[model samples]
Target chain A: MVPNREPVTGRRVQFMISCLCDAFFDDAARAAMDCLERAGCAVTCPSDQTCCGQPAYTSGDWDAYRQVVRHVAHVFHGDEPIVVASGSCATAMFHEAPIAFEGQADLPEIRRLASRTWELTDFLVNGLGVRAWSGRLPARIAVHDGCHTRGTPTIRAVRALLGGIDGLEVLAFPDQDQCCGFGGVFSISHPHISAAMGRQKVDNVRSVSPDFVVSADLSCLMHQQGIAGRQNREYPVRYVAQVLRDAAGGPA
Target chain B: MSRQALDAFAAGIESEVLEAIEIGARSGVDKRLATLTEDYADADALRRLAGQVRQHTLDHLDEYLASAEERLTSHGAQVHFAASPDRALEMILDIVRASGTRVITKSKSMASEELDLTRRLTEEGFEPVETDLGEFVVQLDGDRPSHIVKPIIHKNRRDVARSFERCGLGDYDDDPETITRRARAYMRDKFLDARVTMTGANFISAESGRVAVVTNEGNARFGLAAADVHIVLAGIDKVIPRDRDLALLLSLLIRSATGQRITSYVELVAGPRLADRPSGPREMHVIFLDANRSSVVGSDMAPILRCIRCGACMNACPVYRLSSGHAYRGVYPGPMGAVLGPLLAGNEGFAAVADLARASTFCGACRDVCPVDIPIPDLLARLRARSVREGVILARAGVPSMAGYLLLARHPRLWRLAMGLGRVLDWLPLRRLPLASIRAWFDSRTLPRWRGAQFRKDVKRGRREQEDG
Candidate 1:
């Protein structure tokens, strides 16, 4: 637990880069690393990680789901609290992993691992207990609540982080609470519906007329960005990490 | 159905469905119910108890069904069993033919919609009148209902005016009162003339053999009151163990569906009109339609049987709210429809309906808002898995690719190798790559790009810095 008690690595915490995070949202990973480490926890990127089997589990391939769960469980198999960049992946691991590995001998450990999981913003605010953010960016931002994170503790944490920032005004539309239709493989599986939903989200963002749209889950942001890109609109989507890390500068 | 439905879905999701859903949701403010549910201390307790009652009834359905039949017989109401839609239709048609009544007046029932009873009656030369205002508009326009509770939620007064004008009902009016009055005036003669009134049961109590029906329009009571022969249709699982249990269910059902303190009418009919009654149907017929429910009655998808036909899941669902009900192209649309649509259709027979299982994003919104707490997403996922297993339709990505992807995910080394290859694709123009799945997925999506060293290799530098520090 105290491995990073040394002067320079003093404030760092281990970051469990989700499979998708490691592969695609590398900027988000580095940003999360910067903000989290700067917030006084050393960032430990668990390298041996694969997916949390969210796609497979949601698809009903429980057999394949368990293999990935067990493998990921074994990799992050410690007391180090696993921080996820995507709320969906976080919920998948913490909430659903045990259900996936249900009635099995390895369930106890999976449950134990689930207990230690935390989404990035939730960790930044609740875990670190560092309020009054130093991250400053003078721009109005629209907050897109991801599909899985709605009405969860994660929403409050994301709001808290945005509110804590210096000069960052969070603008949300009336219909901002709807899903962007990024249901894991759903964006691809039901691309037409997905894009339509994403366009709806983009329109909501447009109503607010914000400089950028920010979300904890990069997948949702990417889906919205895709629609914006296709329509040749100026609404850019940014990971909450990128915004928070850029604004806060170092630490509050 | 699913193929065309998918096409409709592609078209409608981009159209004014979003505006229609928003307008309906805005006007249909669910805050009162949310507040009442929060204020009502036993809301959770009541839901659990009602769920238990429904489960108990389904568990001992045969005994209850027998009890209902026996008790209803004593009250002069005949009970019939329909094992399929065809049987149900045939049995009802024969009864109507026996009564020498070709005209039927119907109250809005999802069961009737499921049976496509209206079209059947119309085709067989029985004049069927849809009495509910929403259903009436839907009927006049020659369209299927887009929502369960508010069937014409997709239509405005202008649309209604246009529909009425098109149907030559003689008025082009956007006034609410005028529209209601006109509909009432038109339906008055049909209700008075129809000899048989057919309605769906909300709950059937075996103890008293009484059938309870809830409606906002008050047309249900009128239909039952006017007709000499009352024909009540319900799914077999709609039966409850006792009469008093209806109170607990009504509390949940009333508020959850449309957020009302209570609907305008909650009528319970047991048997037929006795000599003491002022105005009641002289002869009553109750038909419990199985319609392949026996298959789902004891299977893994059995939890769906507990549904009270409340449209809470549909209202709360983001996908459903945007696309409306018609996009589902099923009798029961939205989350509930999406779950049960394929189940009742027989996963083996219907390809279009089977594709409905894939329509959802599997968001947990529907699950969180359910009154009986039917795990809709779980059921949807289970159905999706069942679809994959049955090969009803290879989920956009064929099973072979899913299998290959799963195989790679299970192995860290293979996953890393694949990620490296994917990273190389990321470096190249993704469109130039010949990977069909990737290209198809990124067709509407800008393929995500990764930066810096792979996390597996990059983590060492952090550890090395930690050691040096």
Candidate 2:
């Protein structure tokens, strides 16, 4: 069973623009919004939804992490599913938060938040029952399954959505199963090692030489694209939402 | 701080070592996937069963320990309990001095590595030769094993050739077969000349006092036959309730470790050779090393004691792929090492190695691939929590970072206000920022122009449009 996930029951979802996407990749966030609307959901964007408390939780600051979780619980409370643009953030909320809040009085609220959280791809395919999408990307795209999404339902959701794109040639590369090394604060604490891992991923993408490197998680792409850009390599990265939006003949 | 230590270790690693680790570890990961997929009809169910068995054993470890001691004693084996690695070493020294020659042939044992047994024996004037081929190369090079199962994974063929030449084994031959042949000949002599054989038990059955030791090299069997004394050093966590438990443990262990259906050699050392069975060692000593395992059993870190020494977690670890095991700076490395390093060292060790948990991205690959389903990411997070509770600022942003983010998150208006302020980065040269964190980020990748509050604004505008229409 997928941990902390509950079956979707309605068409309404509270959209969560991950901090990374909110601050840097607004295009991807907008694309995610468009795709969610296309999937026939009454997507509600809560102005108060900020960060997912991943950084604080990962850093081991329980007091600060709880404050953030409590804030999230208050902001996104009630029955509608909370759909997130990023897989890592959704995983942090749906998976790690429950583990962190175990044995605490705040666990029930955290568990409630987790039960309603959903990644964009999983919500589109699994929650909304969009097994195949109609679109035309018309490019060779290599999929980088972020570490968090590799073994989850989102991996299949990504494949099902991408598989339906017309004229899109999906590609695979060596070590594509590896992480792109944007481990949030890990990149800050151990930048060199993180960059080394990013180099390997970027090099693997270079070997395949696809038209674009697409992933459900923008954080991974941001890290890989950064390394590739500095090295003067051709690494056009697109978020899964952006690809889906473009394929559906929406704004580029 | 140990962050510096991990960084220093990573910086010193050459490209060659990184490539070796990637190749060696990636193959283990791929093979493990292949075996688990093809070998079992219900692999995950099998894994769940294995996890349950280990958990049950740990939950009742006190009873198993007592039963194991009683059964081992009745089986004509001396059972010694060690509260720590130092105590285990001290006991081994006395047993060696009492009944063996200066030469001891040792098998590959992570438990012994914890004790630093070979070095301690050498310091005491006893010649302890590592018989595992990878370990022998490591011994010859005066280097520590970077990997758990494959000791010299960081060393390529050329490194082995150089080490062999330095040890006067043969002329420089980097051929894999030649290296194995030469090591075999060298170890054959050590096995014959040694008076004591040292090994680590994979699983000890409390019901039968049978110790199962699996190896690919077949060294333990050879050394035991030639030696008069057999010393098995194992963690107290290795104890299981019954002999039948080996069926599940051994299957998962061999497949998980090296992707083999079965190891080349499986030695179930029952006890010393009896009057009717004269083929084995004349004396046997089984030392159960606690090394804070009993304390761990009562703590949140207890699930770590379910480890079967498979090395699968390290193989699947992406951070370990780049930094390798050396960066961990402990006997155990990778996902398992990150937790075990701090826990085994007890309270004092927490201050030094608890930061190792910060080195991870908390990627779930380690947890996914773990045969016994050890929740490594959760354990790493627990370590991080412990670090914070102990007043160590090991998190990414530390307290100030969390406090700053929290202050903004608690108030929606403040979050928007601060995000608007972040838009100033769009007009400034973010790459030239004097901040170390930003500098580190911009070192390799171009920072995108901050699009602060645009998505939120768009959502608000869309709502207004619908209402107006």
Candidate 3:
């Protein structure tokens, strides 16, 4: 693999492998780690890392949110920056965490954590300064803008990171800002709508006719992948991290 | 409607919504939502103007409302502020009592639903009739509206036939056109005889003190024209800054609502009657209801005040397409309803209305379509976050599984062990213990199979291999 830039060293970083990545998409997570470490940052996965309380929070369970936020805040109480592999989780932390602890004493810590949290690509480009990759993997890819990333303030950082990758042709689809309809447990409870939404996303991806449909959130990717598989569609759903790792001439 | 009735109706509608989603999967929801998004985006400039007008009116609501009242009175109109639903009902009761109104004809108005106006009017010994075909069907069935615009969307033709039979319409054909024609014929007589007419304002122009009501059927115009007294009930948010602003809002309203460029009739009632017009309501009363809107406006949730009630968000929302409006169990349904319902109703129970806000994929389509550009997803997230902070969410869920998982997640050894167990289970299919409740989950949709060991382990293995080499 050709070296693009000297890997930065000695920065403390933690990985938040979102629940979907923990249970599925192991390769993408592995790819994310490889890319992060290669960029010269010391990374550790917090054993206590679970969900970002998004499911409960979105479902309107405030009490459940506190327990989850306290648990996550206590687990990653150290001074190091928390880097999340999933855009949705990072968004939860950055935007929802503080809101989750509004009047509590832990509000300050939650706010601090929110400010420190970053999506993987955001951490790579903005935090680690790994703007370009030297490795080449010729593939036409369509980028699916995850809802949390697009609806929140994190869009620019994610887009810039994806744009800097080499040997990757990014195809833009119309209405890219639309949701894939996997809204966490919503897909499970309201499957018909969720599936319909997923199918819509699959169609958009198919319309682009790219080799892979890529997104920052594995949860969204997994949902689209399920739709593709069920419909027997040929397009693959991939994580942006895995694509970047592959383009860097790293592991699969 | 009683609690039991509402629950049954909501459940029935929700099931239908699920079925629609299944059909939509094959027919396409993405294309539909995309088409709507494009249409809404096209109306962005007009929506912005409407939003600005709404903002200006709201900023000086007191001044405009007073000015509107005075000007309306000068034109032979009476204005009343309904502090609450009961108070509004009482005001209506007083008016009807004096006029000896035996039959009252109402145009489509959600505020009337909130006040249970029909029930109240019936109790006060006056017959209340819904003139709009959709609302008339819902009224005949003794059912609440399932949708704001398409109030009877939940009712198939068969259901309408059943309702018509129940209402003693006598063996009518189940065709939609036939049913509509029957209702129109029945309502035509009531429209002429009814002493009191009740209607909702689409936009209350604070500039000209005119109430602009847009209707496809022209029933509102007919009701206002024929009745001895016309009562216009609206929330404070309906006020716009100027007459010109109505044009912008009307454009967005028509296109987003029914995909039409404009409704058949746009009735601008400056007051009760025009001197040139021989036949118009002799008396006009505008009732501005403030219920819980003041609280919403004072809080960070103020942007909800900018809504134009175009129902574009409902049509564009994937969840609403599946669950329909009844599932929301509020006067409002869909994206805008999910955000505003809880706030307006002030019911914590309404907050649990089927993860309504979370129903969106955060596609921003509703926000894009919003005439006033209310950041619907952002508002939803904020509300959800607030719900989490207050502990109302999990209590409503009746379990704390999420908290338990968070507890397990915080311990390093426990988390690692859990991950290791997940890996083992992945290898041995039989060992899988429904991790993430895939079975219960997959009953409705396909479950994502475990891909074996996590990405962290593979990454560590790769690094170790490199070091050994």
Candidate 4:
């Protein structure tokens, strides 16, 4: 991990990083936490945190979706803005959570929970505004926009941070905003179509031949990685948070 | 069965058909964007206006449709209503049979395709000639239209040229202009001699009771011009409240579909050529095909009714671009088609293309580019939920998982534990797993298998260090 060159502003932004199962189960989660803490932010991990029910919400199981949203809201019910590592999970919390619990008694709380919820990139860029970083990733990287995070301002922030690195170059690949066919249960339920879409994204990646394909959302990166691994293709994918963390000398 | 369609689609991708369709699709959307940027600074606001209009019209469909019928009748056109596709075909066939209409020339009409009118006409010894160049090529080749807007989008111009030559239209070159002229030449005589012409209206204005037909080739105008009897097969959902409302709809439709400022022609046919008018059919038949669309009018998926049949969603869709339209296995193809196809199919017919809705990644590209702002992904998600409850998707993706998630996902501790185990199991050398859902998800990509409670392990180490200190 490279060290940050600029002095910390001495301002502490508290982030309750919801333990997204996908990122949590990986070293990337720790890196993100360390990245924030090293940047002079107070970060807390709610251990009882569970799934945001994005899978169920996307699957259209509103009843089950409500339960998951309810549990997440209960776990992180506070004024401290909740930050998530994945866009889909953040969407589930911010957007889908309120919609799922509309007209309910917990509507106020649900709205509050949604208002506080932010994807990691959004939190880091808007919440923290910690842009400057020093790192040694000296290669052109393609930015893959997850379906849930397309047209988001934080995406621009992520790119700006990536470009701000000492040696890294970030690119807006052709059709970078296109979904990489990782629609959670959609991938498993409709595997053939999903795989076909993944192949198309890979083809675009191959044409560019980028050293790394970074995305704000972990699910898409993870899905693309799986596809590349299965096909024995050399398409490299990385989470933007992990990359940023490594640049900030947050964690190994 | 749906899997086989996708399998064929993968093969089609290798065969270069997807590339051809994508190229055509790209040009159409590129043209649309250029036109839109020139027209409005806030295109989304315009789109929203159109959507609001469509929503209002759908809400009062009975009133507007009645107003349209009354106005069309006064303008000397007999407006007929059909309850379903079968009824619509029967009504059109009855009119054709009674009139002894031999040659039926039709401009591009997806409604005609939806009602399967051409086959019925052909079976009844009526030559149903397709006038639109793309439709003409598709008809001559004994093929179905893959795209709603550009019927022969799947085929390259070279293939179309070959088809033109094969059909004896001319010794055509691969050039699109040559093929266009050849098709026009071949269809010229059909326009001259046809007793009746069939077409679909892009929109029906209730205020004026006029049917607006939009086209690039002017074949629809030609057909209406040459033929004595004009028959319009329209989806009941096409009715808008006012004639002026077409301004927003047409602008968005043209930009979103062809990325052009406007089509070559947007003819508003109010009625038949009465006592004073020189052209148009002496008798005009406007057949409103209900076809279960009336049922969808105020229903949850009615946002799809606002679709002007713009292929922007298809062009914007990654999956549709990869597989081409044929993979959908329905009259309409792509994102909009996934919803419309099943909706048009109705309850009994839904099972045939129920899987079409499943094809989407729920990426919301369709909704984003939609001229009427249809929530395509939400409709698709609703369709998925309906399928699960109806046992259609359950039969394929399995009921156990959805059912299990509903029950166990409610328990946070249990789900976390299971996910934790899943993380550990993923890293294990468990290749070629027999779980259908798992196999399908992992078949194309390997799930990372190194989770092993990394968060917990790191936390535990931190706690140990704190205790030692």
TM-score, predicted candidate 1 vs. hidden true structure: 0.86
Clashing pairs in 2: none
* Clash count (model 1, backbone only): 13
TM-score of chain B of 1: 0.91
Better of 2 and 4 by lDDT: 2
Q: What does candidate 3's lDDT look like per residue over A1-98, in tens digits?
A: 00112233447788877777877777777777777877777888765567677776665566767677777887787767777888888887787666
The segments of candidate 4 whose C-alpha lies over 4 angstroms from its true place after superposition are A1-25, A38-41, A60-63, A98-112, A126-139, A160-167, A249-252, B1-14, B170-175, B393-395, B398-400, B403-408, B419-427, B460-469
Residue by residue across B1-469, what tens digits does model 4's lDDT show? 3243443454546556777888878887677777887888988889889999999999999999999999999999999999988898988888887777688899888888887777878887889998888888888888888788888888988888888788787786898878777777778998888888888999999998899999998988898888888899999999999989888888888889887778899889999987777678888999998888988988878889988898899988877777777778778898999898888888988877776776777787777788898878878877766665576742244212556765544675665576567655645555666676667766688766656456755766876797899
Per-candidate Cα RMSD to the true structure, in Å, reads 4.9, 2.4, 6.3, 4.8
TM-score of chain B of each: 0.91, 0.96, 0.83, 0.93
The candidate that achieves the highest DockQ relative to the unseen native structure: 2
Local accuracy of candidate 4 as per-residue lDDT tens digits, A139-211: 7888887777654555676766676676787665666667888788767766776887788788877778888
What DockQ does every candidate get?
Answer: 0.35, 0.60, 0.31, 0.39
Q: Which candidate leads in lDDT? A: 2
Instruction: Report how far off residue B405 is in candidate 2 (Å).
Output: 1.9
The models' CA-based lDDT, in order, is: 0.76, 0.86, 0.71, 0.76
> Which candidate leads in TM-score?
2
Error of 3 at B464 (Å): 7.9
